[model samples]
Target: MQTALNNPAIIRFLKSKFKSAGFIDGLKIRYRSLICPFISLIKMVQPGDSVGDVGCGSGQFMLLVSEFATPSYVYGIEISERLVKNANELFSTLPRG
Candidate 1:
């Protein structure tokens, strides 16, 4: 899964989510929005490990962790109930590997 983060489709999926969530305006915000969580996930998570994310906006970063690594369980903590709801709704659409 080393190259998973580099896939255009993966990036697009994440970008769309952020856009849909009104978290970003366009491609200008994509790199900063995506890379921060990508780096955090890569540096901190491991396959089959349980993971938790605080301030997990839209839960996209948690989803990225699942894609970039095979976490056994994933949970997110968000201050916004709306974002948590949206994230859960979006997460249901992701293909499980």
Candidate 2:
């Protein structure tokens, strides 16, 4: 977060993520269809399979996949720089792709 102290976009995005109730609500709505199917699909995929997780905020799911049976490489795409930073903090060694 210190790295993002000077970035308005990251600061604003993080502020909104924390200040607004709509963030989590909207996340649930956005992931309504994708959440389960993705886990199932990732389970089916063998090791080394390249999977892209779109809008991978904070990447808990990606970390879960990595911890679970998904030996395949997981890629995380996050539009918000705040999420990118948080995700990196949580899983520093995990590559974005």
Candidate 3:
């Protein structure tokens, strides 16, 4: 499945999220978004699949999966409590479609 990351609107929204997050978090987000192969991962998913991401950091990968894939469910596991909270906050903002 082709990720809509190429969509200008999605790129702008992701950039806005990065900007709103502070510098360190923004850098981490950028690394996760660009350096990590979330798009490639998305390609591997089939509709109705359930995905679990270990060391999911701030859940950016899972968020992208939720946005771009037809996965039945997405789960993210992170060690840091703060990151978990942040991830939950991020998830809350996303619409359940």
Candidate 4:
């Protein structure tokens, strides 16, 4: 996972801590826009569905899906090291089951 933090230049830009509030709010709205479809597809996501999210900026959607769905594993490939670090930190603090 640490290998995700290798792009020093790109990481610097993404690490500037721009207001994620707007981004966060927009994310919720985007989910709302597609909730109906997502609900319909819920049954299609098998236990081992390898859902790959390309251009997954901050990985918020992956976390959201995990709350309701269980697969063999959830693997996200992100290009931004800054977001990777942030995700790592957030998940690290999650209580282990």
Query: What would the TM-scores of all predictions be?
Result: 0.67, 0.52, 0.75, 0.50
lDDT values of the candidates? 0.68, 0.58, 0.74, 0.49
Residue pairs in collision within model 3: none
User: Using TM-score as the measure, what is the rank order of every candidate, best first?
Assistant: 3, 1, 2, 4
Q: Which candidate comes out best when scored by lDDT? A: 3
Tens digit per residue, CA lDDT, model 4, 1-97: 1122122322232333234547764555444424434444434556667665566556654544444355455556778999888666645644443
Candidate 2: tens digits of C-alpha lDDT, residues 1-97 = 1122122333343344435437774565345434355445545757776766799997765655565444557768999999999778767765555
lDDT of 1 by residue, 1-97 (tens): 3544554646675666656444444553366544554664455776678988899877766876776677788889998989889788868877654
Q: What TM-score would you give candidate 1 relative to the actual structure?
A: 0.67
RMSD of candidate 2 to true structure, Å: 11.8
Q: Native-vs-model 3 lDDT?
A: 0.74
lDDT of candidate model 1 versus the reference: 0.68
Q: Show how many residue pairs clash in every candidate, following the order shown.
A: 0, 0, 0, 0
How much RMSD separates candidate 4 from the native structure? 12.0
lDDT of 3 by residue, 1-97 (tens): 4456544434555676667777876666556455656667777989999999999877877877777778888889989999899889888877664
Worst-scoring 10-residue span by lDDT in model 2: 1-10
